[model samples]
Target: MISSVERVRAAYARIAQVDRPEVWIGLRPQEDVEADAASVDARAASGERLPLAGTVFAVKGNIDVAGLPTTAGCPSYAYRPEADAPVVARLRAAGAVVLGTTNLDQFATGLVGTRSPYGAVRNALDPAYVSGGSSSGSAVAVALGIADFALGTDTAGSGRVPAAFNGIVGLKPTRGLVPVEGVVPACASLDCVTVFARTLPEAERALALMAAPSGRELPALEQRRPGPWRIAVPRPERLGELEEGWAEAFGSAAARLAEAGAELLEVDPTPFIEAAAMLYEGAFVAERYTAVGTFVDGHAGSADLDPTVAGIISRARDVPAHRFYADLERLSALRTRALTALGDTDALLLPTTPGHPTLADVEADPLGANARLGRFTNSTNLFDLAAVAVPAGEVNGLPFGVMVIGQAFTDERLVRIAGLLAAPPVRLVVVGAHLSGQPLNGQLLSLGGRLVRTTTTASAYRLYALETVPPKPGLVRAEEGGAAIEAEVWQLPPEGLGALVAALPRPMALGSVELADGSFVTGFLCEPAALDGAREITSYGGWRAALPSLAALPSPAALPSLVRTEGPGLSPPRT
Candidate 1:
């Protein structure tokens, strides 16, 4: 396997080969990245468990990364942060190495990626299209494989829009679920640190790490159980205007989800549309002003600001304080109405953007194109909901994406659903110690595994109680007359299989195991020699059922290997 350091070096080489300068505003020196990777390697050598060990990542320029200057996509507004943003710090602690800072829409004020003076961030797949912003570069970096994942800020669909344009996963966590300290504010109260990655599990891993510290005083997030999900979407007429092929794209995506077993229902979108309009058309415009109004006022009529962004922030000054308060009242009522509309649905599915516009299209009518892109997304943060943007399919070779929105704290549920929609996962049948709730289950979860269902193997196997410390179970194929054995089937990331298989203890190997349904999946199997004199517990059906008697015996520490081997049927230890 290539070491993490080699991967980082190769990523930088790829970036150099492509030479897309506009995708990044600043990058750590090669030596700096090497140093970070070296530190992660040293930690691994010291036996530390780093969830993101050797993972390379980037940050949207607005979020601080100690040695990098945070420009928020405006050169004049740049400032060198003395420390990393809390999100960055958390990711670093988890062993992710920082590659650099990426470009964005100036001050995070637009959905089109062209507002930065640093230069327009072109689409990763095509140079003629807009990359979407203010997370344009972050999304492009991930799409181009320059980084494993990246951090972006989402105030008004910045994170999600870019993700759609780049065919990547954009996770806009529930507001305040990730601390915003040390990040350059876009709309302060509405701003959320977002994650951009190529897969749902990668995004989920980053979200979990960033969410840990901020969850202290927050309401406990509900753990999502796997089952058939009910998905809500806007009624056809209310889906608003979409680009030429986008409506069909969305319809096809909805149909596929239905075929995959999700129950799809249409709901009136009036409240959500009204709430979305309030973000800029209502008094919430002032929030943008509050974040960077002073700077705009100070730099008024200067060439430092992007005209579109300048015009947007300049309008905030006209919104009176009383208007802001009234809008807040209106928003609260709308939120209640929106929640009522959602009812029992697990999540709301929508097009991430109405269209993917070209650079010329955005330049000709910047505000109109940007507004259309945010039609389905602007309401999410305003309503304090969590959303994930996932690539749905392609329209005439261009990427089309669907946004999965859920009520507050349902981040994990959204990712789980997104994963199912994106691709078929690697299913593994886990028995014995690796079953759910067993001591070794963490190994599966840490490798991005999700429990699919509990089932029993076909009646060709026998279960034996292993006399190892911690007392694991071993399943062996029988020549004749064996009982069915219970097992848990888990879906794991295919890329993690090699490492997982490499870590298995003696006698345990991955092999085809047939389930009661007559289907087969790769699962744990023990060598026949390992089960010679082990106690047969096939009648119990599963490890959980036999756990009680095992728990009642003298602890493994109190009983030596000799005592365990003294029984009548016990065989001598093998070399």
Candidate 2:
């Protein structure tokens, strides 16, 4: 391992070599930063266990870092912090060295990195393109290997879009999970202190150190969702207006995640997409003005203020409190609807942005270009969801990425699901009680089951309603006159599945169920003995379609019978 001083020295050396002036807004005198690093080495030498010994990182200009001016990208607004923010203080205590503060959109108000007087943060890979923002500089510093990780803020896509463009990891923890005590807020209630790193481990390590132990009002959620994970994504038809090569890139990215053992469930993205629009277009922008409108107003014609940013805040200042409250309620409803659409799924995956925008693209139409960039990102914080953006590969030779989103406080678990995108898939088919919203559906959700898609069996099988206590289905291969029967293919981890097999009761058995697409998966089958006088329901196509006929049947003394529509499962379908 390199000494702290050596690591700090190397970071400065790389910064010099990269020669990206726009990337940093301030620097702690090199000697002073190295002195801090030297102390870290001394502590470690004295047998201290420093978790981040020799680790060097950068802070977004908007965050407080004592001795360095917090310009937040506008020189007129710069001020020296008396001390480090709690998040920074925590990281520093763990033996990490702070190189300096990086540039950002003035007051962290814009999604595009261009809205800063420090000049547009050029893309690390292609200077002509944007680096993504308002975390622009921090992301570029990490992508260039100048810092092991960097701190940035995300109220909208500021933290994620930049990571997608720079080919690194960006973790925007659940809102309020990381304290915003000393950081400048674009939206006080919505801002999050985010981490950017080269890999998942590094990002997770830093976040683990800085995160508040637990006072956030998050529900008790699982961190490790066992495999055959369900990953939600925008339905193909809804992925509107992509750059030339992005559609194909999204398709390939989704396909790769499926290969990682995920069941890609294409879902309606209406609530999320609508929420994204609200972040900037509705009363939400009022939060940004509330943050620094007076200062910008006082500096009216100062060159330090980005005209685009000033214009946005100026317009937002007049928005009445009623509109903000109305939007807040609407946002609340959208959040509920969004999570409900997810059902038992683990996370929502999306292209970090429509595509990488060139500096020229921003110049042509700053608001339009910036708005387009946030299409996939702006909704996250508004809905109070945690997100991670990782490289998905390339789009027309530019860096691209996909974000995994989950309920608030699922940071660690979300990372686990993000990692499981590479696990081998374990597909299973269910014909009756096991189908989605059925009486027995919770059995699958408890074991981390995911609905791959609602499909049907080949035209060579018969589906029968077996008379079990609570009723079940028996799928039998037809000798003749076979008809296609509806079925649902779900995925589960090997262990959870093995347990189900061990607990199999009566004549119900597991066998290969071929789908209409000719794909075979482990599904429910019936023993000949259990088929005695069973009613054939293949004519109904699926159990859901035939459920009306079975509604009158009484549930067993212990187990409830299946209900029509979505049933009473561990998680009912969100309305």
For all candidates in order, the CA lDDT equals: 0.82, 0.81
Top TM-score prediction, candidate number: 1
Cα lDDT tens digits, model 2, 447-538, are 43545677778999887888886677788898886788878777765544765676677799988888999988888888978888888888
Residue 262, candidate 2: alpha-carbon lDDT: 81
Clashes of each: 0, 3
For model 1, name the residue pairs that clash: none
Measured against the true structure, the TM-scores of the candidates, in listed sequence, are: 0.73, 0.72
Off by over 4 Å in 2: 222-227, 420-575
Model 1 shows how many backbone clashes? 0
